[model samples]
Target: MDPSVIATLTAVVSAVVGGAAGEAGKSAWGSLTALVRRRFGTDAAVTAALEQADTRSPEETTRILVDQAHADAEFERSLADWAGETARLLQYKHDVSNTIGGDARITGTVIQAGDISGSVNLGTPGPPERRG
Candidate 1:
């Protein structure tokens, strides 16, 4: 709407509300005064909105949080699915293919393939020692 019209409405509402505030049954007036104070005196709307937001029903709060969690979960799943699909399409599976036997050699730290490390090396293991 027009800024001037909004200002006029705000002033009228504030005066009416300010006039009614500070007494019994003053919520309506208090709200109006709050609106005025929010615009002119101090930006109290942020504070008021925060305060009012706290009054939200427990169900509403839970619904909001649940919605957020579900969205996050779906987003994560979509990313994982996309990554797997991309990998498959890019033939990353073939990266591990070994069509010929003895093509790779296995080496180990001599960690006792047997019970005793008799002359066994205490290093990490690689592929089996065979070349096709």
Candidate 2:
């Protein structure tokens, strides 16, 4: 599994366990649990790992997920898909603090953004400058 995926999973687990994810977080957690149940239904150890995820550190949960992914190619693909969807769903759930507080001087152009998708032009558009 990719590190980003692991990180996202960790965040999802934390949010869900901590009860800070709200409805969307609950939905994501349900989806993840369903996926695991479907994939590793007969594996009690896997199930136990997931059930006790909240009791363990995020790294431990990540390790169990990564180990499972390494063991099963199909599970890995499914997990990746779940991670992508969960990340999208939980994008805004993550706290973002873009503060320009306290004594701040004036600036020409100040842009503060998070998770930008498209191009951002901060300067006036003009003809290309000629060089010697």
Every candidate's lDDT: 0.37, 0.80
Candidate 2 ranges beyond 4 A from true positions = 93-132
Q: How accurate is candidate 1 locally (lDDT)?
A: 0.37
lDDT by residue (tens digit), candidate 1, 27-122 = 433443353344335545333432443365423432332333355655334333432343333332112322424765656432213123356455
For candidate 2, report its TM-score. 0.64
Candidate 1 clash pair list = 102-131, 102-132, 105-127, 105-128, 106-127, 106-128, 106-129, 109-121, 109-123
Q: Model 2 over residues 34-118: C-alpha lDDT tens digits? A: 9999998868877877788779876787678779999999998898888778777787765455888899985688888767889
List runs of model 1 lying over 4 Å from the truth.
20-27, 30-45, 48-132
Q: What shift in Å separates residue 125 of candidate 2 from its native position after superposition? A: 27
